[model samples]
Target: MESQQSAGSNMDNGYVSGDNEAQMLSSGAKRGGWITFFFVSATLTGLMIAGWGWLTNLIVYLIEEFNVESIDATQIANVVNGSINMIPIIGAVLADSFLGSFHVVSISSGFSLLGMVLLTLTATLSSLRPQQCETGSSFCHGPSKLQSASLYAGITMASIGLGVVRFTLATLGANQFDNPKDQGIFFNWFFFTFYAACVISSLVIVYVQDSISWGLGFGLCAAANFIGLIIFLLGNRFYRHDKPQGSPFTSLARVIVAAVQKRNILLPSESKDYYHEQDGTSKTVATTPKRSFRFLNRAALKTEGDIHSDGSIAKSRRICTVQQVEDLKTLIRIFPVWASTVFLATPIAIQTNMTVLQALAMDRHLGPNFKIPAGSIVVVVLISTAIFIALLDRFLFPTWQKLTGRSITPLQRIGIGHVFNIMSMAISALVESRRLKIAHDHHLQEQQGAIVPMLSLWLFPQLVIVGIGEAFHFPGNVSLYYQEFPVSMKSTATAMISIVVGIAFYVSTALVDLIRNVTRWLPADINDGRLDNLYWTFVVLGLLNFGYYLVCAKLYKYQNPEEEVER
Candidate 1:
């Protein structure tokens, strides 16, 4: 009867222990599977379209509307990008610790709607923005303090809404599946949908913003945000909601505190000397803590007065379970792998911002009448990434596995991504060098805002390369973290990728500032500056970072080797 009840409990929770694949399959279909996937994907599409509509054209908006300097506009864009990525960690913590994913996502969507409305208002009201500079005029007025404050307030609210919802929604979607394979498939499709929505926004909404009207463009984003929130709420019945566990960080902290307090205690040679929790009771086990980070093992040491008469720990701060100690140790072990990705992301962040600036100075004419929007140029990357993710998941990975008799591991995928990134940087430098040559030949260097006699098509190859690289590493990083992190931190695990991207964008901002201050490589006018040299410098950095990643990957050991093999 207890066994039947346990099986029923597992069904309710959408997870089954052991080899109950048949039961999981049926229950998963009812709870999550393809039914919930459609709703989640639709919600993601609407939200992402709203997000990309404002974000893609921000640098141009800053320069044209506010009269901010070109470099300063890029810096501000970088900061905004960084903030958008960084804020997700906070949302993830909130989701995993207190408010559940559905609540967080719903609240964030409202914030997004409010933000987009304010942006639309700013675009509509001339008083909210400075006067547009006349053609061929040297003097341009900057935005007033009121204008800046209103703009920033809108940006802040929108960023919080967008960033918070980004990965929390992904987590919510993944929670529907009981099978790891389904979860993996969901992640791939989630990113594919994400990039596809961005591509649409870049082409359609961005065109509206540039060619039609900014007010209308922003109003559309607000509408999309509202629609997305409604769709998400509507799907609440089908969604499998996970209850928020207490903050996992507290357990991590307890491990450190307990270890420090027991610093003077002698190391135990027997497994019985350490405390282990089993079925909410202290139990003796044959398994001793691993030798690595031996000091942390002391946290689980059975000390006098550490336990109560009922076998529970009297003070959690002074004694943690072995599992708690191991969880902290897992994070420590993965730190180097995570650190390496930060450098990897920094170059990509720099490239994303730089590409927009590059497009502005190049000939963006497609045929005769339709000129490509400078901000929309990065859509090439999104389109490429989305296409390749579909191909890789549908064909490439399957073929590779069949031929090799093993699946492509996440580390291997990341390594391949590194190689492609390096190639992209080199290609970017070469392309920039040719563009500079064309600019010099035409003597366009002396003129500010001069378009180089070079086609914007030249930029596509490098962007496409970087996009392919992203298709590998972005999903790989998310998969790795999700698989390896403590079960209690599943939401935080997914958000770790966002944290990496956030730090990289901030680093990219600092790196750009450093370059501007130290070298003449990046000036306001790209035609007059050595933009090729900056790309070359990134190439060198990429090679060095790749080497560091290789070392880290080699040294790293998987916590669940069997699971990796199954993948």
Candidate 2:
């Protein structure tokens, strides 16, 4: 008879031996320091994300040449962000269940490379056909619909490929360090390196966007992505690949079928653990357990803390509901925390959109002699903010955590981030209020010309505060969702972080539109043409977000599910 491993035991009976079980995780750790490996991997991946931040800055400059309004650009951004995030859910499911992370990462990287190649072609060739686009634009206007469609198609493919790899790689990189004792510091380095990548990309890509041609900027982004893929591929020899565990969907189906047979319950009264049957090497379900209504604990009926006989506790068997089994297939238990994450992301989206508007409205000294390319400033500010945050996290947060009784949990950081984000928006509102006063005094039709040049400098504090908020929120949210969720649903946890951004985009868009509509009801001079009112809306949003943070802080608590204790 084959000996089976006892349930809940960490021992490696499923594997051939103890050494073989060690192969399951950190196989490469034997050859190198786990911390060094994770830090290196995290830095490489961080550079990839930084490239994206730079590209986000570059795209606005590109769109301006097209003369597209802020609304259309925002819509395109939201669509791209949402579609990429949603598609990754499928990619993660596949990686966790069937293809394995190695296959998923490799194939996804290939698709990313292909997409980048096509994007470069689109950028370089569009300038060749000026007649096809609108007036004042270098490219064609009407007849290039087919070309536009092709570019969008390429973007879709690239988004899916890069996005899937981004989701998988971070977790894979974290896996490089098997020592849970240092996992926090490992992840801190991971977050730091990722932001460092953004910092480097911001500095370099800004030059490509402004000093070089538009074609060159897109081309450079494509090249950077390819470089990222190459680095990942070359480093594969230093990595461990987890074997596929089978499809979550297939497991869910089996659970449902078994639940039906067991009279609609998970882990029937007599069944305390899961089991599988195998004739060859394939996995199949054994006979379902029968249900029995034997109370394991009657503490609810007893007053105070009266205890039952310890032997009686062993006699009574506990049964799990079908809902609990379904939950096992997903990371849905983290949904409450995920819901709070959306609030955090809303400010991030606003920083990109509303912050840009505020910057543009500020006084400018362009005066024909000096011109500030919107692209350069945005990249520099964002990269600087990310770098500063990394430094604080590395040097500051830990020290503070040690001094205080409580370590900075994800929820606490997120709550604290909202405070800074709210202040940033409030600062914007104050800047706009001053700008409006100057406009009204001059009786100018447009404040762009009348507003003081120093107003742009005022927005700097807002950007820096926003950056400070990003430090606390973005990576904290990532590490939090990943650590809290069940191991089986790790990839889903990554995607959940993205979903927060996706939802926040639409929410911010709707709020902006609603505020504009509501303000339109006032006289033209009082509302329609008044940009100052727009800042007020952001101010309101900031205040509401702050209040929301307070509620979340109150509700949020961490628990170690495996240990069954409050952390």
Query: Which of the numbered candidates is closest to the native, going by highest lDDT?
Result: 1
**lDDT of candidate 1?**
0.86
Error of 2 at 223 (Å): 2.0
Clashes of 1: 0
So what's the TM-score on candidate 1? 0.94
Question: lDDT of model 1 at residue 189?
Answer: 93
Per-model TM values vs. the true structure: 0.94, 0.75
Q: Tens-digit lDDT track for model 1 on 472-554?
A: 99999898888788866878988998999999999999989999899999998888888889888888988999999999999
The regions of model 1 sitting more than 4 angstroms off are 1-8, 12-30, 134-137, 278-286
Q: RMSD, each candidate, Å? A: 3.7, 8.1
lDDT of candidate 2 at residue 192, scale 0 to 100? 60
Q: What is the RMSD of candidate 2?
A: 8.1
